[model samples]
Target: MQVRFWGTRGSLPVAPKAGTIADKVADALVAANGRSFADKAAALAFVEDDLDFATGRSYGGATSCVEVDMGEGPFIVCDLGSGVRELGLDTLRRCAQEGRPKEWHIFLSHLHWDHIMGFPFFVPAFMDGAKIIIHAGHPDAEQALRRQQEEISFPVPFDWLKADIEFRTLETGREYEIGEVTVSVILQHHSHDSYGYRFRDRDGKVAIYSTDSEHKIDQMHDENDFAQFFGHADLVVCDTMYSLADSVSMKEDWGHSSNIVAVDLCHEAKARRLALFHHEPTYSDADIQRMHEETIRYEELTRDTDALEVLCAYDGLCVEL
Candidate 1:
């Protein structure tokens, strides 16, 4: 399975200002150190190879939508954050070329505004013949979606949509076949409660999407159940929205976790790779890159017999499991 991150921010969507963009350009130029390029290709190559990610590219501003592809037909999406709009546009292009039926299976984590805000702008949801099945653990998923599209909020009403949309309230802990993958949910710690999904294919490959979740210090002692849930997964996309100091002190009960906790959890689960996700909106690209470097160092310092790969998830990132 291939997992693509459309959005990875938490709480809110934010973009860099003009000053930030200028700073990146200035830094890159300084690093070039007056070197001359024969062509734009050579300069582009230098930027790609020499410049670090934070200086060369952005982490993006969208919040929490992901795509899970099993190399099959059905469209499987996770969350409906602002990133979904881009995915929706891309889906339209694919549908236009392939003439495939517009069927989407969306797995929601929770109905936070940031997580559900993209539904109104999702192009496919506005198209005829588009069948959208929103599978969520929350019974009020449809209610929340409809409420967002109310005239007071959005110009377009939910009833005005051209597509056929269905909401399926899923029972957590029960295994269900959703197209090419078998999925199961585990209740997570969050406001109004969030759900973590485990997707496993016929070949036994597993990819777990566990975001907007907080791990308590008291609960960490009893994390064997979570360990079992994450056991042997190829990739575990987790919430790492704060530093250990902040998550424990100032941001306690804020429903977010730290990269330190993420590494510890994945290590205990024996998961192969952990993608740190749900970045804090206030953090600059450099801040996130520093956090990623720090997390890698922490993982190395706390390594067991086998090493677990750690990566910071950014928009447009693709991971194969």
Candidate 2:
């Protein structure tokens, strides 16, 4: 199984600035500090230096979408945030290159705007004979899709989309077969009822995706329940939207997890690796790096038995198992 992140930001979309010197300086300061360039004053000075940015352009600032290719039949996508627009276009390009009909499956955790906003922009839905299966926890995934295509909100209605679309509502603890992969869905604690997915390949490789989940200290203390929910996965992608300090202050119960909590969950679940997702919009690349370093240090001090590998998710980042 191979997974690719199309967007990693949380809350809203963050677009790349066009030749903005301030943005360039912020990127350089972040690189130099090896952390997020949080100090606005310092970041501005770096921008004034006119640093070159061939490497910076590659890290796109799209929002919360992921694509997983299970190497069996069709492509599997997670969420449909603004990043899906690019994923859709890329799918079209790949289909054209390979000379095959488009076939894709989209699994949605919830129907939040940021997670489904890019559905209308997905180019493949306009093509005939394109088979797209939408697996989600929402009561009416089809209704939500139609809402986005309303005349008041969009220029085109849902009926205009030519692709054949199917919706399947998944239940918690039940496993569904999609080609050679078995997917297990679990209901998670989020502002809205969200579903976390576990994918087990025929070869026994496992990947669990549990984004938009909030991990409270009390909840973490209960090892039996949480471990049963996330245990023994090869790769677990989790929500790490706030630092412990930030979470304690105003972000408490904000429907997000801290990096420290995510690390502990990985250790508890005995997951081989933890890919942190749903980054706060305010977190720059440097900030994410700092969080990763802190989590690693904490894990070492705690002597986490799993020795889990921790990584921050980035747009276009791919991992193969």
Q: Residue 247 error for model 1, in Å?
A: 0.6
Residue-level lDDT for 13 in candidate 2: 86
Backbone clash pairs for candidate 2 read: 25-47, 35-286, 36-286, 36-287
Candidate number with greatest TM-score: 1
Tens digit per residue, CA lDDT, model 1, 48-163: 89999999998999999999887667788999999999999987787778775688899999999999999999998888889999999999999999999998999999999999
Cα RMSD of predicted structure 1: 1.1
Model 1 lDDT, residue 7, Cα: 96
Worst 10 residues of 1 by lDDT: 216-225
RMSD of each: 1.1, 6.1
TM-score of each: 0.98, 0.86
What shift in Å separates residue 87 of candidate 2 from its native position after superposition?
1.1
Candidate 2 backbone clash number: 4
TM for candidate 1 is: 0.98
